[model samples]
Target: MAETILVTGATGTVGSELVRALINRGVNTRAAVHSIIKGDRLRHFNPEVQLVEVDYHRPASLPLAFTGVDRVFLLTPFSDQQLIINQQLVDAAKAAGVQQVVRLSAAGADMEPGIQLGRWHRQMEQYLEQSGLSHVILRPTSFMQNFVNYQGQSIREQGAIYLPLGEGRMSYIDAFDIAEVAAAILTDDVAKHHGQAYTLTGPQAVNHTEIAGIIGQATGRPVQYVDVPETAARQAMQGAPQWMVDSMMELNALGKAGHLAGTTPAVEQLTGRPPRSFQEFAQEHRHELMPA
Candidate 1:
């Protein structure tokens, strides 16, 4: 019998793509979503999928979501409550007799005295390590999708990308590559990847200005990268929680320091293909980045 894999955060960016990847591999996939309504879209995409609403607020939902599941793909939302939420999921997975867990962590998660984002993810990694469950941690750098999710509006209206990154570059990975890596690990031998951590990244590093040029060349529009002051970036996020605002500023500081720069071979090692380049990402998302 084939193993049944449960994916938490199933409607999220990487989780949604993971569901598709798993389905493409003909794996038995159970998607644990917070909103059954949103999960209906997955059903439309593939009727063979099993959807279970897992409310972190409700303890009962966790067990039901893990029931009959052999392994789990864990991707938690970014927030102040991330550590606590991850603990809950880890405990639930432990009690459910799940064999392995593939955790979607952030790049630099293992850094000592790391920034807020890295510290939060590292804490979860430590917890998962202590849980005695087989696990694989994927620490992917800045996501290429952030261009569309966070800055697409600006690009659409003004043909510009704004950030406090300065000249710092990062090897931004496509969430599709992350999903494919996770699917490969989840379906392959657990003993091979057990307790392993992979730093997933794109084929190369590029700064915001270079990114702008790539998008412009791909879409046939002049897009410029505007390096705003850190204070201005903070002000732009005024509506967000104080913790989120502060953490984002910390990340911006890291980017400005060139700490997030570097390429890794983990994606290719696991997926058996080189990760997507920023140019490819820009071209594929041109519709979203182009002026409306």
Candidate 2:
């Protein structure tokens, strides 16, 4: 019998792509989503793929999802309660005797102890290390999908990309590459990637100005990068929790200081292919960037 792999956050950017990659390779995959309603995206892969509603907050929902599962791709939503939710998955995975866990972490999670996001990921990494299950920690840099998720409408309507990252170079990675790497590790021998942490990145680091220029070239329209002041950025996020807003500002500050500009060969090392550049990402998603 083939080994079963459970993928948490199956409906998300990386998770959805990871599931597709695993299925493409003929892996017996189980996609754990929060609701059956959200499983619509994965419906095309029915029969070949199993969709299970696994709620991290509800401990009872996990064990059934883990049944017969040999490996797990653990991805927790971003929130103040991340630690609790991650712990719940770890404990359940331990109880289920899952052979391995591939966790989606963030860049600088181990190096920068001050950033709240990194700190949370680091905490989860430490817990997984002690969980006694073989694991792979993927620390990918900021995703290129952020443009489509948070600023696509602005880019289409106003031809502007606004952020608090002031002239700082960032190695924004494509989530597709991250998902490919995750699929590779999960499908390969556990011993080959176990107890390892991979800092995944794009081919090069580019500032917001360069990013805007790339989009402009791809869409044949001039797109501008608006560098907002920290105060203004904070005000824009008025209704969000104070801690979350402060974290975003601090992360942007770190980027502006050029701390997030590093690139790595991890993506190529795992997938045996060069990571996609921002220009390539823009061209591929041109329809989303171009105005209707």
What is the per-residue lDDT of model 1 for residues 96-187, given as tens digits with 9 covering 90 to 100? 99999999999999998998889999999999999999999999998999999999899889999999999998889999999999999999
Question: What value does the lDDT take at residue 281 in candidate 2?
Answer: 96
lDDT agreement with native, every candidate: 0.92, 0.92
TM-score of each: 0.98, 0.98
Give the per-residue Cα lDDT of candidate 1 at 214. Answer: 96
TM-score of candidate 2 relative to the true fold: 0.98
Which 10 consecutive positions of candidate 1 have the poorest summed lDDT? 37-46
**Residue 96, model 2, lDDT:** 93
Q: How close to the true structure is residue 191 of candidate 1, measured as C-alpha lDDT?
A: 99
Error of 1 at 238 (Å): 0.7
